[model samples]
Target: MSDSILFNVIPYAAALVTLAGGIARLTAKEPAAPPSPWTPAGRTVLAGASIVLFLHLVGLAAPRAMQVFNASPARLFTLESLGLIGALLLSWGLLTLGLRRAREGQWGAAVAFALVLSQVLTGVYVAVALRWASAWYLHVTVPYLRSLMSFQPDATLLQAAPLVIQVHVLASIALLGAAPFLRFGRVPARTPASVEPGLLATPREETP
Candidate 1:
């Protein structure tokens, strides 16, 4: 597909699905038992996600401020370093969570975890191999995302980005599009009944 359709068209569709899914999840009836409290892996994932998401949101919403922040070499290094740390934590948590889900036969959750793990891994590689991404991100990615938000997506800058960066962006969009069904749309596994249906059968008395 063309870059225009990939970057422009896909993001809007993903965003719409994410928004609708979020609303549906909020209004959906509660399960008989509430979801279990966060496990250690879950907490780790949340912590890392908080850091990573906060930085991305700020960069997207306030590019000029990010530019100013990245202008200082020391500050830029710190930002990139922190981002890498968050990525590491995210990956570790995903590894544990994915394995556990796979072992339990929760294939749907396992797939979600695997996709997210790949997404986080690509992001980590981009931050390292691309080096100074915190600085350059303000120039290309931030603007591309802003244009997307404004309904005037221009992939010109993104087209010029490295293949890995392009893959990272595309993966994120795909994940977003899938969030409704894969993430928020999941249902709890059903437990087996205490008594087997076959065991409940009774023999009829012989006719006199």
Candidate 2:
């Protein structure tokens, strides 16, 4: 079906972005910079954000774990509660971080935070609007993931999903692709190099 084809292609496109971004990071250099001053509040916010990111990924890993654990309704409900908590943490963490960055004149950082908030809000909406989506997600996504891992993606499982869910999937793919380039998981900054006036000149230009 066309829907399934789109799902399959979108992941690869997102992957391309991630791969390209990573390669660009690896080959690029940065200017020398002094170490940033860290404060207790900054550390707390960072730790919270890290935890929220991990909590978001937990759902992806949970299905296998749950299968092994023989997941029940009670356990599923607990997971649902945990998802809500993660969403709350994400919302709070992002809002505070965005405000702090904006106050410090870091408009770019503030904007990035706002962009991330959209994703978090989408997830929160799903958690609320789509009843038992977490449980259903396992049945749909886990298999699709397993298939992809084996180099054979089967998007048919999710073809019948609502439009919002499809959009969510695409957004997740974009996030995965972009995360490598973003501050959350970016590579170390390389030392900057000075370029001479004729550094890039050809043989004719080097004559003087």
Candidate 3:
């Protein structure tokens, strides 16, 4: 299989696993104990997803680097820098979330997992948009901008493409940086171990 297909498989699989885990957590019958801060199943699933995503990012970068020989330096730089930053953020967010969830308990884990997942999904969407845009635009605009930077810097600055890309880059960074903090901010004082099962406890009758 092609590198892109292979690379994509990891994240897709990760996403599937995460979805399944989330569903299981949602449907599980509450135990007698309060929900634990951490659930073994939840941590394992989330951790696996995070590792897969990390590999996916690395896979994504390899092709871009290879394309550098044919592409303009400026365009290549922009793409590489943005991609690297995005990957780093993704890694950090996933690692922090996974580790915290494993150590702290279920609530912490849920918060971290949710935040990281949100960022991951958002990033996937953005990447799809970017890929579509690159293909539809004939891949000329990026290379052209790179070439124009030295000769007609002013004209390039006036173009909207770079600015738009920059916005996306910044937004991605913000999402990564903020996710961890958000998870922490909402953490409850006491972690619930397990929820009580449906049956009610009965009172004993008084002896005669």
Candidate 4:
């Protein structure tokens, strides 16, 4: 009972945090100076993440797709293999962006980068170690998520999952909580590379 509450409360709180942050970001004023344009590395990170994210959304909205893919071990292996590939790309992307953000003294981005990097690293671990989460997601996490959506969240199934899997869930909640504050999702414009003080900063930082 208590574990179920803990599981349910965490994600709801995270949702509120994410919502508030998103609103704040949207309403926030523009910065004075533009930052550096996004490097190819940064863009690559964003692109890979976006694809991975889209895949998740599609899976959630259309469980049948996953069911179709997971009907056989061979099929499930292919799906997990693709997920691993995406995770690796995301790691490379984060590394590329993290180095640049750190060098520019974008501490906020640096922090967000660390949080998400941790999540992705753990995600890779889950993919490698568990080896068939795509199918298990349907059997366990999906129902758990459904319960959360229905306002009667339950961790009953998850409580039985392995410790590393629990850690992955915690990391995911943390990432969701931090989402509203981070600029990782922001895309810089394709304007001229202006060193001007009034130009916008990198997507990770506010302009001067």
Q: Write one digit per residue (lDDT tens) for candidate 2, span 8-120.
A: 76677777888888888878896645665654445655665675556446656676775544368777777677667767676777777777777877777777777777777
Distance from true location, Cα of 84 in model 3, Å: 15
Question: Tens digits of per-residue lDDT for model 4 on 70-147?
Answer: 888887778787777877888888877777677777777777777788888887887777777676667667777778
Ranking by TM-score: 1, 4, 2, 3
How do the residues 86-201 of candidate 1 rate in per-residue lDDT, one tens digit apiece?
Answer: 98999998888888888878887888899999999999998888897666578878888888878889989989999998898889988987887784223355778689666778
**Candidate 3 wrong stretches, greater than 4 Å:** 1-64, 69-112, 132-159, 162-167, 179-208
Report the Cα lDDT for candidate 3: 0.46
lDDT tens string, model 3, 93-120? 5556565665666676556566565555
Candidate 2: C-alpha lDDT: 0.68
For residue 160, what is the lDDT in candidate 4? Answer: 90
**Candidate lDDT (C-alpha), each:** 0.84, 0.68, 0.46, 0.76
| TM-score-better candidate, 3 vs 4 | 4
Candidate 3 lowest-lDDT run of ten:
132-141
Best by lDDT: 1
TM, every model: 0.83, 0.70, 0.28, 0.79
TM-score of 2: 0.70
The TM-score, computed over Cα atoms with residue i paired to residue i, of candidate 4 is 0.79
**What TM-score, to 2 decimals, does candidate 3 have?**
0.28
Listed per candidate, the RMSD to the true structure in angstroms reads 6.5, 11.4, 16.3, 9.6
lDDT minimum window of 10 residues, candidate 2: 181-190
Better of 2 and 3 by lDDT: 2
Could you tell me which residue pairs clash in candidate 2?
A: none
